[model samples]
Target chain A: MSIEIVNVSKRFGDFVALDSVSVSIPSGQLTALLGPSGGGKSTLLRIIAGLETADSGRIEIEGVDATKLSPQKRNVGFVFQHYAAFKHLSVARNVAFGLEIRKRPKDEIRERVHELLNLVHLSQFADRLPSQLSGGQRQRMALARALAVQPTVLLLDEPFGALDAKVRKELRDWLRRLHDEVHVTTVFVTHDQEEALEVADEIVVINEGRVEQIGSPDELYDSPANDFVMRFLGPVTELGDRLVRPHDLQLLTGGGEPDAVPGRITRITRVGFEIRVVVAVGEQLVTVTLTRNEFLSLGLQVGSEVQVRIAPEVGAVVGQPRLLGAV
Target chain B: MASHPSTRTRRGPVTYLVRLLVIAYLFLLVAWPVYLVGKNTFADGMDNINGILEDPDIVHAITLTVQVAIIAVIINTLFGVGISLLLVRYDFPGKRLLSALLDMPLSVSPIVVGLALVLVYGGRTGWFGPGLESMGFQVIFATPGIVLATVFVALPLVIREVVPVLEEVGEEQEQAARSLGANAWQTFRRITLPSIKWGVVYGVVLSLARSLGEFGAVKVVSGNVLGQTRTATLVVEEKYLNFDKGGAYATAFLLALVAVACIIIVSVIRPKEDR
Candidate 1:
């Protein structure tokens, strides 16, 4: 289901958790509420799920007002960061909880529970208590439980936030595949820019209780609305007065190009297939990313004098420096 | 590198001394007195126990004590779980004050609690006693009075146990339940209750022990009427004061058995539940 949030505001004592934030989440799309910690992304997701109340706003789900609806009435599935598994209940029973509460037929509840457990790849652990499952398995069980009710919108608050890094990556891909198969309008809150950019069909950047920008991953990365959005989406380094991606800056052995700025290489670190070179340009530090082949050809090392310029094709295509500052 | 020695195998003289002191102190304060009570009760090889079991008044007193204790535990469990949930999950004015006040029963003397109940619910001179008696309900110096006293003395035990568990368990699972289309009642029944089950059980056992052993409050409010208001604890005092030390020792032994059983049950269940 599509979700339209309008003028939502939330306050906890003196702290403003969400400030007049508004965003439209399209139906059947995986959207991420991305932000730094305590930036109100999770709060927004909770408000959408009716787990939290907004001070002043209207939440319209599938074009119907849901601001006053209880979480049970809203029909939005929610997953918590800590897995929130019913510790005493077995995995299958946990998955069947919503159906049981809805008074669904016993046979149907069992069938649905089986189907969901299989979907989450946890059919074997159905009879085990949640504590017996690993972190990833528990989170998957939580996901299966949330999906058991066939909610219109699936809301997850840092669903993989508690998992280890390797498990988090696996779950991210798994979630994307699951979203494709189920096609439920999904909204997940995360502070991880990479996770959002990698998995979400659309991204809403929130900061300091306000919506900073909203767009697809490439649109947000390539055309950020302000300095915060740019700095948050990926790595950016100061070049003279403008902030530019490290890979966008090209390095030359000597000052040849008219627009090239001279700088001294301060550090060179090889990571995977790329070489990250930090340059001291005037008083500002700029990073230039070079391919491994290019770095070997140039024979550059620390303290090597170099000239930095935006790549010619990129500069020509953009027609101006990518100035990502407060706008 | 050499492996470090295990600390368990390295106990020093200080540790031994401390362990000895604790054992000696427990023996002197608890074990010795309890042993004497058991010995005295069996001095005639179960004759005293069998004799009390046959006495109609003593049997009636024991039955009445069990009934009062069961009722008090029920009331306290319901009230305790409800108050604990409110304290842990909701916010309102005077919440801190209410939380602080829940421990009053634990700190206040049982005699004072009974006197307070009498001052409010006593017949003839109590605040609501005359009106309540007119409406066909006698509170002070009656069965209800005894129940009230017992309930008041054991009130905080359940709340004290359940509140910490409730706080530790948090509201996340409850929220998850609600989000899965479970209503408030279903959430409590299926989610909240199960998570706090151990805490409630521990509290119920403790409250049961306390209610069974209640003496000062029951004394003040019960008026200690023979066969009607005299409980197990009251019968112990009555038998001792009347020089029937054998009967008193037998009753005390039974009460002590129950209390020890409660402790053993809790200790047996605690480690498993904690895991």
Candidate 2:
């Protein structure tokens, strides 16, 4: 089921949590609400789930007005950042909770519970409490529990946020694969840009309780709607009036006169498969990335003077004034 | 492990002296009384205990105390869980004021609580007593009056114990249950209830102990009606007044035994909860 959050606004006393935030999430797609902390992405997700009520707007689920409906009638599965598994319940019973509350037959509940445990690869931990499992395992169990009800929509608030980096990556890939298999309308919130880029079909970047921009990962990176989205996704360099990514800038070996912009190299750092070269052009610092072979051929090093050239097709005019400086 | 010279110097004879003082204080205040009571009750070859058990008034007092304790526990558990949930989960105007009001029972003296209940529900002169009596209900100088006073005295114990656990567990699980098609009541039963089960147990046990041991409040409301209003504590006081030393010791021994049992249960349940 598609979720349409229209002009939704919520406030906590004097603080605004969401302000006229509207977004249309398509069915059967994994979307990510990507933003910094305190950006109201979680509030929007909670509003859609009916776990929170908006102060001044409406939400429609499957084209039906769902603003007044309680969360129980919304049929949306929510996985919290901190597992939220029932601490006193066995893993199996936790997964069976939704079905049990719906008054499903005992046999059906057991079957679904077993099926979910197997799906999350926690069959052996069926009898174990949530505290017995690792952070990643608990989140997996939480996911299984959320999916047990076969909800119309699935909402996950930083589902792998508490896990370490390695476990987080593994779960991200696993969640992507799981979404492919289940294909429920899924919306997950995270501040991790890499996670949103890797897993989501669409990324909704939020800032200060408003939607900065929403688009596919490549679309957001290549042609950001504004300076905030550009700076938020990855490194951006300003060239007079236009915005360009670090990768879009090319560095020539020779300090050519009159044709290329002359810049003094300040730092050269090798990061994984690419080499980053920070060059100073006047007061602005430009970052350029090159392949290992290209760096070797250019013989680029710190304290070296180089010529910088912005590619012809790389420039995208930033729609708004820069809200933040380049990081 | 290497011990720093500064740390070693910090732990002087004063620390050891303080530890000894605490030990001596506890031994004198708690252990000495318990030992004396145990020795006195069992002193005279069980004759005192047997006579106290055979007395109908004593037996009736024990039954009444147990009945009131059980009823108080049930009522407190329901309202305690509900009120604690309200305090922890929701934000509202005067929330701090309501929270402060919850501590009234804990701070106010039990005798004062009895007087307040009497003022509210005693007789035709009371605030609601005449209307209640017209509706065929008697509160003051009756079992209901005794229970009201006891409830007022013991009301804060359960709420105090349960609120911290509810705050620690948070509203995420309840929100998750709601999203999973569980209604408010279902969410409370499946998620909230289980998470706060140990807290509720500790609270109810505490309330039970307080209710059973209550004398000051029950004294004012019960009017010490023999066989009807005389609770276990009241019987002990009565036995003392009558100069029946053996009977008083035996009843006090029984009350102490039950209180000790409650402490033991709490200790057992607490360590498991920590895990």
Candidate 3:
């Protein structure tokens, strides 16, 4: 069962929120909707969830038209950005609510609630209210609550936005594992490019309600369609009309310029296991990565002349200009 | 209100004067009435020499007043919360107009409220007069009339309190619940209900307080028969008219004490979120 969003558009009074956006979300794969704020990423998710309707378009799940379907009939689970669990209900009750609403057998609901709670690793805190849970725990509870319904599709809007960095990373991995075991059609939205790269099987980069590009992280990173994809994927080292990985450049051995690009050392700083060295060519400050021993051997202070070279044919090419609306 | 830098900072004379004047105005306008109600009701033996605590009729009148208020409040709680949910959750034609009309009770004079109800069910020439009285309904100049008047005076407070909170909650959580395959009623019971429970509680409390002290409307409609439609306020008026100042004071004191108690209880249970 796949979701087909065809020529979807939305207008709010005077402002057009989405303009002729279309995407197909295949079943059993995790898709990330990446965009900047007001880029209509969340709006598209809401349309899929049927929280908001498109002004003109067709939405279908598994060949069944869902264009006019209410949210309840859409049969899609949504985890909101702000962990919209029932604040008054305990975690167990919150998870059980979906089942209860579906009129599942009481015993079945009890079993499912426990199972979902265990899935999210929140079984211990199942009796506590949502207000009492930390942000991470609340998000897990919301996910568990969404999962309880056995929905065919799961949509999340900025699921990790409220979480701290470490927790965000942990939950991103957790979501990937959950998606694997459940094997459900899942679509999640996030502005964090790293998160989209790490968690999503295919990232659909959206900009102002339109799709910019859609591909796997490695495919996009190794062969970027444009400069936006390259800079967005990882830190870059830009040289003459070309961008290369920082690690591609090596320091020269001799005092004279090696048969390569030559420039004066502008700055150096330690980063994690490696040190980054900046070389100035005219007005440009090109960055290169080096080991501690290599940096020490060079013994170059600020403004010391140095030689650097990058194999342009091997790495990424300078791609298209970034479209203004390509969030 | 201007915020001066600090106690140690330099201050303008105008700023200082404005702050002092506002404080005094609040103290006089709001605090002093509360203070008088508390003081007069709790006066000692020397103050009680005026017989402000010893009249059995006044005591009985206060009891009747409270009974009517409680009935009015309970009925209002049900209607107000129901109507508020309807206004906040549903989208129907004239919904905006219906919502705006909820505040008609608050805007209309209490005496006008009583007259309007009397015109509808007055039993003399009212809209429902013949039909109701033929079925043995003693609505006008009766206990039901008093309750109807109090209810008319108290209906809007609850709606005002509950509506804004419902607006803030929006349709998000309810839509979320329904999307989980919850039936419409189940969605409302589970999602919409809990979200607005605090707001409902606060609205009901305020409704109770206003119902307890409803005088103008109740006076106009309740055919003031002594010891019957004669509520605590009417008893005080009767005593004062007879030149029984001490007895009037006693009756007024009893009524004030009960009203104060209801107010305190409501204030305590008002929604902490204040929305």
How well does each candidate superpose onto the true structure, as a TM-score? 0.95, 0.93, 0.77
For candidate 3, list the clashing residue pairs, or say none: none
Best by DockQ: 1
Candidate 3 on B160-239: residue-level lDDT in tens? Answer: 87788888888767877877888778887878877888777777667766776677888888888776777877876777
For model 2, give the TM-score of chain B: 0.93
**Top model by lDDT, which number?**
1
What's the true lDDT of residue A272 in model 2? 99
Q: Tens digits of per-residue lDDT for model 2 on A1-327? A: 399988999998898999999999999999999999999999899888888889998899888899999998988889999888888789999899889889999999999999899999999999998989999999999999989999888999988889999999999999999999999999999999999999999999999999999899999988888888888898777654457787887788766544357778998899999999889887878878888998899887898888877665764547332422222
Cα displacement (angstroms), candidate 1, residue B126, comes to: 0.9
2 or 3, greater by DockQ: 2
lDDT for predicted candidate 3 compared with the true structure: 0.81
Q: Over all chains combined, what TM-score does candidate 1 have?
A: 0.95
Second chain TM-score, each model? 0.95, 0.93, 0.82
**Number of the top TM-score candidate:** 1
Q: Which portions of model 2 miss their true places by more than 4 Å?
A: A253-259, A301-305, A315-327, B1-16, B269-271
DockQ values of all predictions: 0.86, 0.82, 0.60
Candidate 1: lDDT of A264? Answer: 92
